[model samples]
Target: MATHAVRVSGLVRSFGDRNVLDGLDLAIAPGEFVAILGRSGSGKSTLLKAVAGLDYDVTGDGDIAVAGEIAVAFQDSRLLPWLRVVDNVELGVRPGRGTAALAEVGLEGRERAWPSELSGGEQQRVALARCLVREPRVLLADEPFGALDALTRIRMHDLLRELCAKHQPAVLLVTHDVDEAIELADRVVVLHEGRIGLDVPAHDADRTHLLRALGIGVAA
Candidate 1:
């Protein structure tokens, strides 16, 4: 069995007496790609924030430790408009790692281009390259492709899968699109009402079964 890259037990989070995560427990193995699915206000993003140590009010019994640093990609590209693409990617690199990271994301020739000059997909690629430059042990993405159009989103999904495979980071993606999750993740975890409602492998049959379990009708 693969060793766990992240473990959570009894995790609880609240905002003004309204609990968002209640006793959530999960274990993510190294090199695994996991997708988190949930409706609005289901605490999916909150969970990622807590794991990344960006949320200070979370209380949990388990610890999340990565073999290396953790990197996050948010819904927005979060690129610096004043800087060129390569420069933005370089921000996350230690000293001499930016070029390699950009190359890894297939942005070798576009390094000098400004964010405004690139397509939305390309900008998102830049954001991903920034995260990749960190050589993270874990990649936490919160709706990273949410704002893109359908075609662009699909392309980004493929890029993300290829990059994660190449880099071998344990990935946790928060998305509302079930089909996207099924296609990209090794495992799909559904968060409902502040708890884990379903956890299953992402095999075709298993994804169908999970959808059924969640009372979401699968297409005929």
Candidate 2:
């Protein structure tokens, strides 16, 4: 049997009377890349937070297990303004890992630059590098490329694929773009009504089917 990098079983999270995640279950094998798609209030980020163990206060009869370290890259770069590029990546990690991680993400010489000096994409690269420096066993990414322009977003997708291939960490990418999910994920999952509505391989996927699952309909 293949080893799982992350496992969540029977998860239930609620905000007052509303249940964001209800008895959700998922597992990610080592080196697998999975993307999640859902509508605005379908509990996508809430699920990711649960898997990442960021939301401590939850009512659930479930367990989330990660074999090793976990890291998250958010929509915003979230780099400290005062820190230099490399320093941002190095902030809480070991000495040399940051340098190697920066190289891995294709930001080799921009280490000395400040957050304000770099473009949006560059800052994201630094954020990605920061996540990579820890050598996480599972990476939880919440719309890491959603803020960039079209061209830059595409570039970041390619870079992300390359980095994942090299590092081989199980990845869960949460994004609203269906095309982006299809392009990057080994498997794509759609969350509907706070549950796993569809889980399928990315290749030759039915986009309309996924859209419908998310309660979106085609218009004439």
Candidate 3:
């Protein structure tokens, strides 16, 4: 059996009277890339938060097991303005590790620049480097590339794939882009009404069926 990096069984989370995640269950094997596809309010970010151990306010009736350290990259870069780029990436980590991680994310030589000196994409790369410096066993990404332009997003996709292949972390990428999910993940999971609506291999799964599951239909 494959070693699992993340496991959640019978998980539940609520806000007010609405259940954001209701009895959700998931398991991710070590080094597996899982992309979660869903519309707004489908609980994708909530689920990632739960897995990252950032949502302590969540009330659940299940267990979550993660093999090692966790890191999260969100839609916003969230870089500290006053810190230099290297300082941002190395926050709590060794400077050498931050340098290497920045290089891994294709941000080499820009370490001394301030956050304001970089473009949106470059800032995001620094964010990626920061998260990666920890050498996390599981990476929780909540639409990390969503704010970038199309070209930058494509480049980021490639960089992410290369980094994941090299680092071999169990990655859970939460996004609304169908094509992006299929392009990046080994398996694509669709969430609907706060539950697993469909889970299928990204390479050979039927796009039409997946689109239908996501409530997207062909234009007449």
Candidate 4:
């Protein structure tokens, strides 16, 4: 068995003259949660897309490996408007699995609700249910909770931690929020010019150091 749920070697991606990812390498242990922090256009999403095998036109000079199924959740819930909530979760999974997945995300009785009827947080929950229903080995969450309000984001964070513990899938969360990364990730890496500039365990993450690395000044 592979020791890592996801691996990238010598990864490089470019658009026109700019290289978004230049020889970046990363490894995610099975069941470990990692968060990535970077400035806008720092290639955080690009790296996640590469791991999910969703990169095409810009992918160059890299190898990505995964031990099992990979699922992705974006800032947008991306649920099908026409499908009932349960049906959305069941899209790529077995018919009966949606109910269990929805239950896991605290939306058990909402299986019949329409996407239009769900609140923003509820829609994101449905999105998570859809991803978790696949029993994925790796879950790539690209600012999954970025759209939620502060209180809802906090709730979603706790829910995500619980779900990840239960499912034991390696997770890669890309976000701009430093506090969010500290709260959720076992490890956090700051991406600079497509390469990892600072990698540290979240529990001991230095706020000033992280902020400085992102080219932001700490108000000392």
lDDT (C-alpha, whole model) for all candidates: 0.85, 0.89, 0.89, 0.93
Q: What is the per-residue lDDT of model 2 for residues 1-220, given as tens digits with 9 covering 90 to 100?
A: 3479988888888988888888889989999999999999888999899888888776665788888989999999999999888889998877766777888888888878889999999989999899988888899999999999999999999999989998888999999999999999999999887889999999967788878878889674
Residue 90, model 4, lDDT: 97
- Ranking according to lDDT, highest score first: 4, 3, 2, 1
Superior by TM-score: candidate 1 or candidate 3: 3
TM for candidate 1 is 0.90
lDDT of candidate 1 vs native?
Answer: 0.85
Q: Once superposed on the true structure, which residue ranges of model 1 sit more than 4 Å away at CA?
A: 57-63, 204-208, 212-220
Among the numbered candidates, top lDDT falls to: 4
Give model 3's TM-score versus the native structure: 0.95
- Model 3 clash count equals 0
For candidate 1, lDDT tens digit of each residue in 111-220? Answer: 88999999888889999999987778889999999999999998898899889888889999999888888999999998887899988888842756667655678898
Looking at candidate 2, the ten consecutive residues that score lowest on lDDT are 56-65
Candidate 4 whole-model C-alpha lDDT, 0 to 1: 0.93
Alpha-carbon TM-score of each model against the true structure:
0.90, 0.95, 0.95, 0.98
